[model samples]
Target: MIRITKSIISIFLLLSCFTTVVRAADFKPLPQWMKTAVFYQIYPQSFKDTNGDGIGDIQGIIEKLDYVKWLGCNVIWLNPCFESAFQDAGYDVINFYKVAHRYGTNDDLKRLFDEAHKRKMKVCLDLVAGHTSIESSWFKASQKNEKNAYSDRYIWTNDSTIKPEKFVSGKFERNGTYMKNFFDCQPALNYGYGQPDPKCPWEEPVTAEGPQSTRKELMNIMDYWMEMGCDGFRVDMAGSLVKKDPDLKETTNLWAEIRTHFQDKFPEGILLAEWGKPQQAIKVGFMMDFIIHLRNSGYDTMFFNKTGTYRRDTCYFDIKGNGSPDFFIKNLTTQLCAAGNDGYICIPTANHDFQRPCCGERNTVPQLKTVMTFLMNLPGIPLVYYGDEIGMRFIDGLPNKEGSQLTKGNRAGSRTPMQWDSSDNAGFSSGNNSSLYLPIDPSASRPTVEQEKKDPSSLLLFTKELIALRGKYAALGNRGEIKFLQSKDNQYPLIYERRLGKEAFIIVINPSGKDVSVSLDYDRVVQKVFPVLNSSKHKIIDYKNKQLKISAEPLSYGIFQIY
Candidate 1:
């Protein structure tokens, strides 16, 4: 009897261990579609104006669906098209259930989803989950003198006169001050606090009825859209939901619960967080998080760092090539190590909030080609910001539109209308130039799709080739294993290998104006080397013993298959 009981106990232990592993994997499994997704981020108001109103709309995007597919992006991350006051662009969401009038009606969005699906692509809407426009019905209801269901939906102090940091008072019948997430016109929706302070009696726990209801409403909003053919959501300010969560423990738990429900209902649905910390965001429920310019992740050291904005004037992708890859590599390595297989780290050429790679000094075709190579070959989802494929210049000195100017800098420059052709208003809109959403690039030589499609060496063609190459190679994709082949002596010519099973490819990028050679001490013996893609005119590659020698020209890049 003792021996039988021991055997049964051992069996139970093993079963329990197996269950734990299975559950853990189930909780945070990366969706299959996200594995190979190449995203095109469109700022809706700037993409294309089909209505002649100078504002881009759903029908306009629907018209450009083929153009996006032709560019090789399978997924479209559309900025918020929901009903909004447009104080902070479209981010100040007013009604979660309705589409913005400027963009189009609900049926137009449905048609967009259908059209995209017809072309074998998916669309992800930007979800402004953290806050709502001050004009939203929920906020209006919450501000009443009498208590209502939404009274506690937002964080409010007990006394109207008491305004804390990031809190606003006045112009309300309510006896308390409300919290603001970003702009003054936006009021934060409460998801509760991590540790409710005793001094702040208004602070509620996550389990409070108000917080619980808010979570349910958020889920409802997601469900409403998913039921309407939406594939997923790119949540804006995903990490800021739970207040005062130092380590984001409670916030993480909140997302974990939401993800559980989200996956159960729509297993294919993905959540892309705007949060810069991929390590923590992926640990929670997000399938992807952006490594943007906001977190000081040294991403700026590569492409976007303005002269005095960062530690160095020269970025890794600059024409002068005075920058070091060490800073960028270190931060990327840390994020990749921490994130592991849980999710992917999304890297963008430049989002709507920052300067494009074609800005300032790094605007040449060779320089842009090197940037595209590095971005496309990396082990993450490459987000091609609208107008970036053709090297659209970020027009400086543009007046702020819809609160595009912030404390850091004015983002109006990057939010200009897309330059489709050299025609009137760059083919963005037929309206008067002054009445357009933003001014078109005034430069006579500004690159455009109409012109680039006819040129073999245009940045647009290079970007397209890079995307196609990434699609053709499983090793060059997100799930592939990346091994940086950097030695102290070869830092300038950044080298890395992407491998999947038996296939492997080495990428070399030299972002400098001078020629460079690097001898990499790799363990594998190179039986043969085929240049898959080469930006350099010379085919300078040799292998001796276990060492591999590669020579690259100024502002050059190459992808080689190894046998």
Candidate 2:
């Protein structure tokens, strides 16, 4: 009987072990789409190029799949890879089905999609449905005749009237025959078309008004891409879809309809909207993100000194335009509770189409990492930009005295080149040196993926480790109830605590010349503490007499687990 009982007990233990491993892999922390998703945005041309075309291609991305997976990112949000006339990145889509010959062929795209899925990572293509290249087949056909079947696919008004001086829409303008353009060279679509082109069903409006037209057009689009096995979309200018001529309410409704259709079809797919307005976007079930600058309130901001960090306000209750540390703590707590169901506040350090933070502005890695920790671990969802893992190279003023290429301080500046190795062209392309579109950064201190892999504390490794840590705790990611610890810190350091039910965390940041002492007595909720990652300038000293004291190197952050 004893031997039989022992065998049964051993079998039960085996089953328990198997279940634990499976649970970790099948961690469905968030709702259908977001659980276990770490999205990495790619600026294609700057990511890599092959065949000496001086432009990035689909094949270039395939070569770097291992590097992407190594970063622990399981979701890829690629910037536009469609055919275009090279204006405003690739927001202007020329062909929806075919891969741009310049980028590669259909076979290359198929291969890329296949490889991406094989690595257990999902791929989301940029869908610029709002407008198309004026050179697109449908647009060309529509422009041929005023009453063409494809004429009403876009928001076009052919009054031949010159635009008003300093009018409402300030995107861009061409001649007196100006069509509404988010940028120059992009003509707005006409409101309602009688029929759609044979190739494009979205060429014509379904009804006279835009609401019904948008519904039909967006549904058709969702059907095509989902059928092609796309995971979802990082929709471009989603807020601009409804057009301001009729006000944003109509546009916001269009988004709600668009979001619902995709959500119903690809229930487990991701949808990250680039809408700047969070209040309106969440209504339609979308995640809104920042451009380059992260919404921040550093303790250093309060100091009237060399450091530029903002000092937090005295009261933590108000969520207005107050950029205070206490304000951050309190408001973040409110966001944790409310923002998830309403809309997700995606805080990112920088993206491809924006100014690089490192251009001429000197801030240590610790200072940068501290900010990263604060943003990524906050209650709401965290969106990481492409090169933000490592300090990226930056160029200043479009017209510089150094004769280097001048970026518009918009998308062009950050869309330079990927520093993979210290190679001649940063391993971006194999073409001849002069054939390159953008010049390689010349600094020797440029951080490369190869070099960063060897260093555990490298910005790349640190980001990866931190991201993985977030995955470990379901409470840390998405949004939940958060509470900031009580403290009277007069510019000593930005210290606070975060709580989600029984789960609680402490955040401390030191962006100054001297180290400061951290005390648990500031809050009555002190218990045992365990340290997460901190910048090189900081260390976790022993908890002595209810006080944690250490010499924090400037621009440092500390994340602690309290039990």
Best by lDDT: 1
Question: For model 2, what is the error of residue 362's alpha carbon versus the real structure, in angstroms, after optimal superposition?
Answer: 3.2
RMSD of 1: 5.0
Error of 1 at 18 (Å): 15
lDDT of 1 by residue, 212-305 (tens): 8999999999999988999999999999999988866688778878889888889988999999989878877798999988687878878765
Best by TM-score: 1
Candidate 2 accuracy as TM-score: 0.76
Which residue runs does candidate 2 get wrong by more than 4 Å? Answer: 1-33, 165-178, 190-215, 245-248, 287-338, 398-410, 429-437, 484-492, 517-524, 535-553
Give the clashing residue pairs of candidate 1, or none. none
Off by over 4 Å in 1: 1-24, 307-312, 432-436, 441-443
Indicate the TM-score of model 1.
0.93
Count of clashes in candidate 1: 0
